[model samples]
Target: MAQQERAIRTRRTILEAAGAVFDEYGYASTTISMVLERADVTKGALYFHFSSKESLAQAVLDEQVPFGAVPEQPCKLQEIIDMTFVVAQRLLTDSLLRGSVRLTVDQATPPGVDHSGPFRQWAERLIALMEQARSQGELLPTVQPRDTVELLVGGFAGIQLMSRALTDRADLAHRVSVLWSHILPSLAVPGLLLGLDSKADRGLRVLSAVPVS
Candidate 1:
C-alpha cells in the first residue's frame, strides 16, 4: 500500500512539473529533459509513468477535467455558472489547468496528440446540464441546448485567453461574470435570471465553501 501511494505521488509530481513546463514553453518547445529537470525524477521513473512527451501532454490535458469542479446546484444553470467560475478561480493559481487550456488552444501542438478531448468533455458535461435546464424551464424557449453549450464553451475559451493575455488572469473572475451577465439574459428565463448569482466573487465563495481535501 505504501509503495502504491508513493508511486501515485511520484506520478502527480511529474504531471505537475510537466504542466508547468508546458504552460511556460508550450507543447512544441517542451522536452523530456525539461520535464525531468522540473520534476527532479529519474528518466526511468518518468518513462515508467509516461512513454513520451506527447503522451505526457495528453495526460496533462486529460487530467484537467476533474480539477476545481464545483458541487452540483439545485438549478442546473447555476450549477453551470459555478462550474465555470470555479475553474476561473483555480486558473489563477493552477498551472495544470492553465497548461491544459494552453495546449488545447495551441495551434502548434504535435499532430499525434489530440487536444480536443477536454473541449469535448466540457461540451458534453454542459450539454447535459443545458438539456436539464431546458426541461426545468430555466432556459429561454428559443435556446437550443447543444447550440448554447457550444457558445458557452467557445465564449469561455476566448474570454479566458484574453484574460490570460491582458492581466495574466488577474481579472478572469470579473470577465467571466461579465460573460454570464451578457449570455444569461439571452439564454435564461426572466425569473431564473433574477435568482441567478453571477457575481465576480462567486468563485471565491464557492471555493471557500468547498472542504479541503
Candidate 2:
C-alpha cells in the first residue's frame, strides 16, 4: 500500500512540475529538463510517468476536469452557475487547473493533441443539465438545450480568459456571476429566475459546504 501511495505521489509531483513549467514557458518551450529540475526527480522516474512533452501537456489538459463541488440546487440552471463559479475559484488556487487553461488557449498547441476533449466534455455536461432544466421548466420553452450549451460554454471560456488576464483570476467568481446574471434572466423562466442563486459568493458558500476534491 505504501509503495502504491508513493507512486501516486511521484506521478502527481511530476504533473505539477510539468504544469508549472508549461504554465511559465508554454508547451513548445517547456523542456523535460525543466520539469526534471522542478520535480527534483531522476530522468527514469519522469519517463516512467510521462514519455514526452506532448503527453505531459495532454495530461495537464486532462487534469482540467474530474474535481469540483456544488450544492444540490432545486434548479439545474442554478447548479450550472454554481459549477462555473467553483471552477473559476479553483483556477485561482490550483496550479494544475490554471496550467490546463493556459495550455488550452496557448497559441502554439501541438498537432494531434486532444485539447478539444475537455471542451466537448463540458459542452456535453451543460447540454445534459439544460435538458434537465427544460424538463423541470427552468428554461423558457424556446430555449433549446443545444443552443444553451453553445452559449454557456463559449461565454464561460471568454469570461475565464478575460478574468485571468485582467485580474489574474481574482475576480473570476464575480465575473462569472455577472455573466450568469445577464444571461440567465433571458433564458430562465421568470419563476425559475426568481429562485435562482447566481451570486458571486455562491461559489464560496458551495465550496465551504462541499469543498474541492
Give the root-mean-square deviation of each candidate in angstroms: 0.9, 1.6
State the lDDT of candidate 2 residue by residue for 1-213, as single tens digits.
998998899999988888788877887888999999999999999889888888888998998765445677778888888888888877877778777878877878878677777788788877888898889888888887887778887888888888877988888888888888889878998876778788888877778888434
TM-score of each: 0.97, 0.93
Off by over 4 Å in 2: 211-213
* Candidate 2 to truth, TM: 0.93
lDDT, candidate 1, 1-213, per-residue tens: 999999999999999999999999998899999999999999999999999999999999998778747887889999999989999999988878888888999888888888988889999988998999899999889998898888988999999999999999999999999999899999988887899999999999999988887
Clash pairs detected, candidate 2:
none
Q: For each candidate, what is the lDDT?
A: 0.91, 0.82
Q: Looking at model 2, report the run of 10 residues with the lowest lDDT sum.
A: 65-74
| lDDT over C-alpha atoms for residue 25 of model 1 | 95
How well does model 1 score by local distance difference test? Answer: 0.91
Worst 10 residues of 1 by lDDT: 64-73
